[model samples]
Target: AGDIKAGRAKATQCAACHGIDGMSKLPEAPNLAGQTEEYLVKALNDFRTGERKNEMMTMMAKTLTDADVANLAAYYHSLGKQ
Candidate 1:
């Protein structure tokens, strides 16, 4: 389990593309609201580990700790029912 408050705080960095509420601000960024936690975690981890190949995501994800990943995933997944 992750801390929603902590995730929200950390999500400021993500708000430029992915909105404060997990919606996307730009067309290039997919809306993250209602995504599965498992899927978000996997995608972030893949970006961090170089398994995924988005330049922006790779750079952004590299600094994330495991807890950060979990928390972010939890926060985004909690946004809406899918």
Candidate 2:
């Protein structure tokens, strides 16, 4: 398991879209809490690299380093679906 403290800190930018606990209020946004780490990492990489295209997500993911991806994935996985 990764460090929750580091994950939380890294997730600060994500709160606006994903919510503080990973439950997104936006119908279009997927709830990431409890999602598999593999999925989260892949999705983020896709967005960052332009394989996936969401303006906001691309912008956000673009700024995340590999460690940030791991930490955020850990935090969301810990939340576990809602």
Candidate 3:
């Protein structure tokens, strides 16, 4: 839970594309809130690892630590049922 809160703090950067609640502002950006943690983690990891390739996401995820990925996954997962 604390990690999720921390993720919220980190999420301000995400808010430029994904809304505060994880809704997307850009048509290309997918909604993230309410997504499963497993899926979110996988997506982020893929972005980080370059398996799933998007220039912006790859760039973003590359800089994020594994803990950051998990925290973000947990936070967005917490938004499930929103």
Steric overlap count per candidate? 0, 2, 0
TM-score of each: 0.95, 0.90, 0.92
C-alpha local distance difference test of each model = 0.91, 0.87, 0.86
In model 3, the Cα lDDT at residue 57 comes to 92
Model 3, 1-82: lDDT tens per residue? 2289888887887889998899999999999988988899899999988889998898888888888888888887788765
Candidate 3 lands at a TM-score of 0.92
> Candidate 1: global Cα-lDDT?
0.91
| Clashing residue pairs for model 3 | none
lDDT of 2: 0.87
Order of models, best lDDT first: 1, 2, 3
Q: Which candidate should be chosen as best, given lDDT against the real structure? A: 1
Model 1 residue 12 distance off true place after TM-score fit, in angstroms: 0.4
| Tens digit of per-residue lDDT, candidate 1, span 3-82 | 77788888999999999889999999999997898999999999998999897999999889999999999889888863
